[model samples]
Target: MYAATTIGGGLGTGLLSFYLGIGVAALLRTMFGYDAWDRDFNATIGYIFGLVGWLMGVGMWGTWGREWFGLKIKDPHANSRKELGWQRYFMFNVDHKVIGIQYLATFLVVFMTAGLMAMIIRLELMGSGQDFISNKTYNTVLGMHGIMMVAVAVAAVVGGLGNYAVPLMIGADDMAFPRMNALSYWLVPPVAVTLLLSPFLGGLETGWTAYPPLSVLTDSAQTFWNVAIITFGLSSILGGLNFVVTVMFMRAPGMTWGRLPMFVWSMFVTAWLALLYTQGFAVALIMVTLDRIAGMGFFDAERGGDPLLYQHVFWFYSHPAVYIMILPGFGIALEVIGHFSRKPLFAYRYAVGAFLGILGLSGVVWAHHMFTAGIPNYLHGPFLVATELISIPTGLIFLSALGTIWMGKLWLRTPMLFALAVIFNFACGGVTGIFLADVPTDIHLQDTYFVVAHFHYTIVGGEIFGLFAGIYYWFPKMTGKMYNEKLAKLHFWWMFIGFNLTFFIMHWPGIEGMNRRIADYPESLQTANLIVSLSAFLLGSSFIVFIYNFINSWVRGPAAEANPWGARTLEWQTSSPPPVENFLTPPVIAGHPYDYGVPGAAPHVTFFPPAVGSPAGGGGGGQ
Candidate 1:
C-alpha cells in the first residue's frame, strides 16, 4: 500500500536508526571512558538519528534532502499528487490546501488526545487526597495535558488556517518553497511520537514550562521531552521562514502590504515572531539535553552555571510565544467580524499597527513570568510595567472588534457567534492578566489555580475560540460542503457556557489558596473542587457535538457556493477547494478588500482587466 511506503516506512526506518544511534553513542561513550549503557546519552543520540531517518523515509530525502549531497531530486515515490479526494490528504502533496488539511487533522487528533487527558485530570480532582490516581500519575497527566495543548495552541491556527488561506488571500499559487513546507509538516510526526513515548519512559514530572534545576534533575523522560520540543522548534522555524518569504515576494501584482487582508497581516507578524524567538526555547532545552547526556552544567548549581539562566532563556521565547498563539486568533476574530458585521474594518491601519505593536512588545515582557522566580528586585517593576504596556496594543485590537460591530449589520452566523464571543472572553482574560502583571498581586497568584484559570481564559478563550471561528468561516471554501447550521450553533453554545462556568469558578478556589499540580488538598477546599470538576466534565463533553458535526458534515454535507458569505477577499472569489493553481486565471487587485458600500464599489479583485468609465470599476484606474 502507498501508506506503507510513506508513514509506515518512516516509522520502520526511524526505529532502526534510533537503535543505531544508541549503538553509536555506546561506542563513543566507552571510548571516552564513560559507561557503555547510558540511557540519557543513548536516547539523546538515538532521537537525533531517528528524526533524520523519519524525514528521509517520508520522502524528504528524495524530494529535498538529496540536494545536500548534489543528487537529483524527484517526487520521492511513485504516486502522483494529482490523485483526487481523501487520498491526497494522505499523500505527500505540496499543494498548500492539502498540507493545510493535514495540519488540521493532525492537530485535531492531538487536541482531542489532550482534552481526554484533561478529563482524567478533572476526574482525579473530583475526590480529595489522591483517591483516583497517585500523585505521580496526576503530575504526568497534568504535564502531558499542558504540553500537548501548548502544541495545539502554537500550531493549529497558524499551521492550519494560516497555511490554507494565506497563499490564496495573497493570490499566490503555492508557498514559495513547497518542499520546505512539506518538510515542516513531516517533522511533526516524530515529535508526536516522541511525546507519546515519554509516559512509558517514566512520565513527565515537571510542567510544560520545563524550568531547569527541577527539569535537569528529574529522573523521568526529560531527554525525550527535550529532543521532541527541539525538533518541533526546528519545524516551526522552517515554517516561519517559508511564510516570511512567501508573503514578502510571492504576492500577486499590486498586492502591496497596505492592501493585505487582516489574516495575512497577522500571519506575517506571527511568522516573524516564531522565526525569531522559537530558538530560545530550543537552545535552552539543548543545554538541558547536554546537561543530561553530555554532562554539561548549563543548569547544574554545583557547577558555575546558574539555574536562573534557564528561566531567562526559556521565558524569552515562551513569553513571545503567548502572542504567537493569540495574534492569529485576533486576526481570525477580526476577519470574521469584518465580514459578518458588513463593515469595512474600522481603523484598519490601527489594527495592523496593534499587531506590530504586540510583536515589538512581546519580547520585553518575558521577565514578568519570572516575578516569583527569585530574580533581582530591580528587574521587577520594569517587567511589570512592560507587561502592562503590551495591553495597550491588545486593547486596540479588542476595541477594533467592538467598533466593527457598532451599528453594522449583524449576520449572526456560527462563525460570527464565535467571533463575538472572542471579544467577551478575552475581556475577562485581559482583566485577569492585569492582576498577574502587577507585582503585588502576581506574587500571591503565581503557581495557583488562579493562574490556571487566567491562562485557559486567555488561550482557550482567545486562541481556540478564534480557531473555531476560522474553521466555520472557511468550512465551505476548504471542504466544498456546508456544515449543519443547527448542530454548529448547538456545539458553540454548549462549549461557551461550559467553558465559562468551569474556568470562572476555578478562579475562586485558587484565590482561596488552592495550589496547582498537587493531587491532595485540604478538606476545606473540597466543595469548590467538586464544582469545578463537574463543570469541567460539562465543558469536556461539549466536544462530542463538535466531533460528530465535523465528521458528518465533512463526509456528506451539501455542496457549497464559491462565495458563501459574499465577502470581498480574494479567497472567496475562487472555487470551493480551489484548483491546483488556486485560481483558473490570475487575480488582479482592483480595490480595498473590505470596502463594502461605496456607490460604485470596485470589486476587490478581478480575473481580467477592467475598462474606463465603468461604474462597477469606479474605485480603480484603467487596469
Candidate 2:
C-alpha cells in the first residue's frame, strides 16, 4: 500500500513537472527569442523521464506483475506489530503513532546536532574576542543553530506528539489524510540533511531570517538554505492541510466542536495559520533562489527589487510562524493546567476565542519584526496598534491559566513543574514583548540583544518549556513506562534556572546597545558576556539531565497504569502506549472533558471492546 501510494504521487508530480517545463521553455522562446532546445531544457526533460521510469517500475509493473503472476505479495492488512519494525521507519508508514515516534527521534537527532553548534557558539562567546574559531565559522555555527532550532520548534510537538496523540485524544482512528501525514514526515529527513550539509556549500551568514540583499549576495550555503527552507515550508503546508482536514472531518461520533480537547483545538488553529501563511515564505525563498540561480530580480536591490519587500514577505510568514510555534505550547499549558488543578479549564470559551483571535491577528502584526527597516512613520503606528492589540487575546491565555490554577488542587509532578514554569517564563516573555511591539521602544531594541533576549524568552521560554511539560505528561502514553520523578524534577529546575540565567541578563547587554549576530563585542562588555556564556553552557548542560531521565525511565522505571494522572480525558482511558488502532472501540463522549466535583459521577466514561471484559460491550459508569 505504501509503495503504491509513493509511486502514484511520484507519477503525478512528474506529469505536472513535465508540463511546467515545457511551458517555461515555450514562454522563454516566444518572449525572448531564445532557442527552444537548450542544455538546461534537456536536463529537465531527462529528470522528468527518470521520474516517469521510476513511477512505472514501482506502480504499474510492481502491482500488475504481483497480481497476475500470483506472487506472494506482502500482506497489506497484516497486524501493525510487524509493520512497526525498524525497517518500516525508513519507509512511509500510515500509522500516526509510528510517525510521531519518527518525528520525535528525528528532531532529537537534529536538536543534538544543533546543540553542538550552540556549544561552539558559547565557546566563541566565552570571552569578548574570538578564541576557538574564526568569525566566519562562528557565524556559520550560529546560523545553523538558529535554523535547526527553528526546525525543531516547528516539528517537535506538532509533528511528533500531536501526530501521535491528537487523533486518539479526539477519538478518531487516524488522521483524515494519513498518506499526506506520512509524506510530511518523510520530507523532514531530506530537508534536515540538506541544512546539515549547507556549510560544505559555503555557510550562510544572514541568520535564519535570510533578509534580502545580504542573502542574495551571500554564498552557496544561502542558496541551499533557501531550498531547504522552501522544502520545509512545503512539509508544513502538507501537515497543516492534513491536520485541518483531520480535525474537521475525523472526530468521533459525539465529539462536538466545543468538546474537542484544547490541545486539538490549538492544533486546528495552528494548522489554519500554517496553511495560509507558509506559502508566503515559500514564495519568498523561491524568489531568492531565482535571483541566485537564474538572476531574476524579485529581491535584487541592484535590479530595482526592493530589499524591504523581501523582509515584508518573509516576516508575513515568520510572525505568524511565531504563533505557530507557541500556540501548541499554549494548548499544552492549558491541558496541564486543567489536569493538575483537578478542575474544568477556566474560560474554555475565552481560550478558544483567543486561539482563533491570535490566528487572525498574527497576520496583521508581522510588520513589527521590520519596524526598523524604514517603513513610513504613519505605517508604524498602525502596525504598533495591531501588534499591541494582539496582546488582548494573548492576555486571555494567561487569565485562563491563572484562573485554572488559582483555586484548585495543584499537582507538582514533573509535567506540572514544567507547566508552572511555562507560566512564569511566558509571563516574563510576554511583558517584554510589549517593548518590542511599541514603536518608540522598538527603535532602540530592534537589532540588539534585547530583541534576541525577548524572543528567546518567548520561544525558548514559552515553547520549549511547554514542550517539556507535554513530553513529561505524555511520556508514559508514548512509551508505557513512567519517568523518574526525582530526575525529572531535577532536570526541570536545572533547565529553568539555567535558561533564565543565560537569557535574562542578556537584556542588560541589549540595553547597553550590544548588537546581535556579531562574533565579538567590546572589551567593556567582557564581564557580562562571560556571565551569559557561562550561563548558556549551564543551560545547555541541563539537557544532560533530560537525556538521563528519558533513557533511564524508558528502560527501568515502573510501568504506568492507565489514567495515572487521574484526569478526565479520552486519552487516559486507554492503555499506556495505546493499542495499534489507538482505540479498540471508539470512545463515546458523555460529559465535558474537564468536569470535577460532580457527586457520584466521574468526568469520563470509557467504552471498552468486548475483549476488554465488558459484557455489555460498553461501560458508562464514572471512574
State which candidate has the highest TM-score. Answer: 1
Model 2 steric clash total: 0
Global local distance difference test of model 2: 0.80
Question: What would the per-residue lDDT of candidate 1 be over residues 419-515, giving only the tens digit for each residue?
Answer: 8888888999999999999999999999899999998998999999999999999999989999999999998999999999999999998999999
TM-score to true structure, per model = 0.96, 0.88
Kindly report which residue stretches of model 2 are placed more than 4 angstroms away from their true locations once superposed.
1-79, 82-87, 600-602, 608-623
- lDDT string, candidate 2, 1-623, tens digits: 55445545655655566566656665676677766664334333433443344333333333333555867544322324645455455444667887888898898788878987987887887788778888778888888999899988888888987898798888887788765687687667657766887787687788888887788777547876776688789889999999999999888767789888889999999899999999989888877877775668988666788888888888899999999899988999898888899877899999999999999899998889878888877789899999999899989999999999988989889888888888888899999999999988999999998988898998888888988998999999988899988888989999999999989998988989799888888888788888998998888999999988898888888999887898888888889988777777767776778777656654565674546553253222367
**Per-candidate clashes, comma-separated:** 0, 0
* Model 1 regions more than 4 Å off: 76-84, 609-623
